[model samples]
Structure formats: C-alpha cells, structure tokens
Target: MTLPTSYRAYKSNADGYQNLQLTQVDLREPKPLEAVVRVHAVSLQFRDLLVAKGDYGLPTGAGIVPCSDMAGTIVALGEDARRFFSVGERVCANFAPDFLAGEPTPENRAALGGERDGVLAEYVVVPAYSLVRVPEHLSFVEGATLPCAALTAWNALTGSTPIKGGDTVLVLGTGGVSIFALQFAAASGATVILTSSSDAKLALGRKLGAHYTINYKTTPEWDEEVKKITNGRGVDHVVEVGGLGTIERSVNAVRLAGSVHLIGTVSKGASGIPLIPAILRSIKLNGVVVGSVRQFEDMNRFIEARGLRPVVDRTFPFERAREAYKYQDAQGFVGKVVIEVVEE
Candidate 1:
C-alpha cells in the first residue's frame, strides 16, 4: 500500500478545545522498530480534555495532536518491525508505550496525548512493541476504547490484589472506566454496585450486570447506602474515579483492608481523602495510571473470552472531532465518545 506523505490531524495548543484546529501534517517514516498505523478510530478521555485545557499537569508541546487511544490498521512497517507485526494488522497502541510490563518507573512513564504527540490523526508512527493486536470480536471503535479506560478498569480489578468470585465491587459512575469495571467485576463472578446521578443510567448499569445501583444525587450519603447494601461490611473493592470529591466516601464504602483503585479526578472540589478513616480501616489506595502493554494484551484476551463489548455512546465524523471533544466535556454520555478517522 502506498503511504501518504501528509495526513489530516487535529492540533491543539495551550488555549484548549475551542482553539483546536484541523491541519495537514507531514508523516514521517517509522524507524527500524516502529510501524505506521492508519488510524481508523480515536476515543475521547477525561485526560484528553485536561490536556486541551493545559491542566494535565504535564507539558504538552505546542501544536501536539491530542488523544491517547486509537484503533487502526498497520499500513506500513519498518524493516525490523516486520518481524513482530505485519502490514494490514488491526492494532491499538498502549498509552504509555515504553512501559511494557511490571511496575512503572520514572524513566518509562512517558505517555501519549500529554508528554508526546498522540493518535488523533489519519496516520501515526509508533513503536511496534507498544502495539497490540485488537481482539477479533471488537470493532475499531471498541478496540480504540481499550488503551486507557478499559485497561484502567482491568488494572483496578486484577492488579496487585486481584478480586475473585464472591467479592464485591463498588463503581462510582457510569463513565467509561467505571462501566468497564462493573462489567469486569461482574464477569469475574463478583457482585457490582454502581452509582450515578441519573436513574436511567443506573437502570442501564443493572442491565450491564450491576447487582445494585445508587442514585448519588438522591442519596447524598451514598457511602451509608453502600454499607446498608453490603450489610455494614462494605464492598471488597472500589473503582474510585471521583477523586477528591468522592474519595472520602469511597474510603467509607469499602470493607476493612479493602482496595480503592484511584483512576480519575473528574470530580471538582476542595475536599480531600479522609486520612483518619482510611488509616484506621487499612484501606489500600491503589493509584491506577492505565496499564502496561502486557496488561493491555491480557485484558484483550479476557475481553475476547468473555465477549465483552465496549459501550460507545456516540460517534462523530473526523471533520467534527472538536465537537466530539465538546460532547464528551458535557459529560452527558454514559460511555465513550469516538471520532471516526477512517470511516468504517
């Protein structure tokens, strides 16, 4: 296949989403260990919004393409990269390309969409080692949602202290990560309790295997509700995505010695974690930053085995990529919002 010398991509500056511009960029040839992917679909994340607003707590260079997760077909491979991945393979790259496995280190912590250029482009060149084959059962859009949201959920459930059958999981909202956690925990035979302000989304959560649902808006002290539901023992794990706004309650919602996987700070507030209660209860606060490439591959296998389909609430055309960002920022969707780069 003939590779284009230039392709369309969205470039953002410190000015944020409203200033994002669609531009044509020169596509560089991949190095010996790299491969070029023709991006089919890209998914939006809260982190992407942060980056756009210059609030990601990292340096995003001027005019950087913004979006970490993408599913694409490998249209070209560098000389040495061909040994591992061939042209025409469907794949997705890990968010942190260098951190292949094990505990993350400072040196291996570089990530896309913030520290480097990202995948919201017609084509991208990435290291072959960072790429994983998309599951056969998943479409490009579904596969695109895995690198960040799904992996964060996977690490939360199956990380250092893996949950097992009979365990209970408390998910904070119906966002991408929380919804994936609900599905994974339920699939592993654990009971899932999902909370959302919307009763309708709660009902949808029930259909997705949440054993119980709580409308946090209706029950402000949702932690007490969780205790009541769990007979005062609390849940075995909490997928704590609400950060400062909900960490205190998350600590209260988990059982003694239970784990709280911290994945997001979507909730805005001045409140912080309850140190006294967390210390007294021996709460395990695990800060999840997505996962490694190996974990991404493992999660893909489980997704395929369980036939889990990612929930994509809506899709926007490539030309409307900025609108996709705005839609995700509105937080009205229960799941992921996607931008189709190469129409399926």
Candidate 2:
C-alpha cells in the first residue's frame, strides 16, 4: 500500500478548544522501532479537555495534537519494526508508551495528549512495542476507548489484591472509567453498586451489570446507602474517580482493609480525605494512572474472552472533532465520546 505524503490533524492552540484547527502537515518516516498508523477513531477523555484548556497541571506544547486513546490500522512500518508488528494490523497505542510493565516511574510516565503529541490525527507514528493488537470482537471505535479509561478500570479491579467472586465494588459515576469498572467487577463475579446523579444513567448502569444503583443527587449520603446495600460491611473496592470531592465518602464506603483506587479528579469541592477514618479502617488507596502496555494487552484478552463491549455515548465526524470535545465536557454521556478519523 502506498502511504500518503501528508495528512490532516487537529492541533490545539493557546486559546483552547475553540481555537483548535485542522491542519495539513507532512508525514515523516518512522524510526526503526516505530510504525505509522492510519488513525480510524479517537476517543476523548476528561484529560483531553484539560489539555486543550491548558489546565492539565502540565505545559502543553504549542500545536500539539490532543487525544490519548485511538484505534488504527498500521499502514507503514519502519525497518526492523516487523519483528513486533506488521503493516495492516489493527492496533491501539498505549497512553504511556514507555511504561511497558510494572510500577510506573517518573521517567516512564510520559503520556500522549499531555506529555507529547497525541492521536487526534489522520496518521500517527508510534513505537511498535507500545502498540497492542485490538481484540477481534471490537470495532475501531470500541478499541479507541481502551488506552486510558478502560485500562484504568482494569488496573483498579485486577491490580493489587484483585477483586474476586463474592466481593463487592462501589463505583462513583457512569463515566468512562467508572462504567468500565462496573463491567469489569461484575464480570469478575463481584457485585457492583454504581452511583450517578441521573436516575436514567443509573437505570442504564443496571442493564450494564451494576447489581445496585444509587442516585447520589437524591441520596446525598450515598456512602450510607452503600453500607446498607452491603449489609453495613461496606464494599471490597471503591473505584474513586471523584477525587477530593468524593474520596471521604469512598473511604467510608469501603470495608475494613478494602481498596480505593484513586483514578480521577473530575469533581470539585474542598480538598482532603478523612484521614482519621481512612487510617482507622486500613483502607488501601491506590492511585491509578491508566496502565502499562502489558496490562493493556492483558485487558484486551479478558475483554475478548468475556465479549465485553465499550459503551460509546456518541460519535462525531472528524470535521466536528471540537464539537465532540464540547459534548464530552457537557458530562451528560454515560460512557465515551469518539471522533471518527478514517470512518471505518
């Protein structure tokens, strides 16, 4: 196949999402260990919004393409790249490309969309080693949702002291990570209690395998509701995506010595957890930053084996990528929002 000499990609400007532009640029040859992917679909995350607005707690390089998660077909491979991956393979690039496995170090924590140019493009060159094959049962759009949100959920459930049958899980919302957590925990034979302000989303969560749902808007003290649902023993794991705003309640919702996987800070309010209660209960607070490439591969295997499908709330054409960002920022969607680059 003949590779294109150039392609179009969206680049964020200093003015933020409103100023984002689709530009045509020359494509460069990949390094010996890299391959060029023709991006089929890209998915938005809360972090993508933060990066576009220059509020991600990191410096955004001028003209950086924004979006971490993408599914694409490898259209070209550099010399020696064939040992790991071949042209025409469907794959997704890991968010943190360098962190292949094990605990994350500062040196290995460089991520796409924030630390580097990301996948909101017609084509992208990435290290072959950092790419994972998409599951046979998933579409490019579904595969696009995995690199960040799905991997974080996978790490939360199957990480330190993995959840098992008879365990109970409490997920904070119906966002990408939380919904994936609910699905994963339920698939692992653990009961799930999902919280969302919208009763409609809660109903959808039930259909997605949440054993119980709480409308946090109606039940402000949803932690107590979790306790009541768990017979006052609390749950085995709390997928805490609410950060400072909900960590205290998450700590309260977990059983003694249970784990609280801290994944995001999308909510607002006073900062700080209930230190005394957390200490007394011996709750494990594990901070999740997606996962490694190895974990991504492992998660894909499980997803294929269980036939789990990602919940994509909406999809936009490549020309309407900015609108996709706005739609995700609205926070009404139950799962991921996608931008179709190649429109497979």
- The TM-score values for the models, in the order shown, are 0.99, 0.98
- For candidate 2, which ten residues in a row score worst on lDDT? 10-19
Alpha-carbon local distance difference test for all models: 0.94, 0.93
For candidate 1, the 10 contiguous residues with the lowest summed lDDT are 266-275
Superposition-based RMSD of candidate 2 using all C-alpha atoms, in angstroms: 0.9
- Candidate 1, 1-344: lDDT as tens digits: 98888998889996879899889999888899999999999999999999999888888799998999999999989999999998999999999999999999998888988888999999999999999999998999999999999999999899989989999999999999998999999999999999999999999999999999999999999999999999999999999999889998999999999999999998977888888999998999999999999999999999999999999999999999989999999999998999999888
What candidate 2 gets wrong by more than 4 Å, as runs, is none
Error of 2 at 205 (Å): 0.6
Q: Pick the TM-score winner.
A: 1
Residue range 264-299, candidate 2, lDDT tens digits: 998997969888998998989898899999999999
Instruction: Find the candidate with the highest lDDT and give its number.
Output: 1
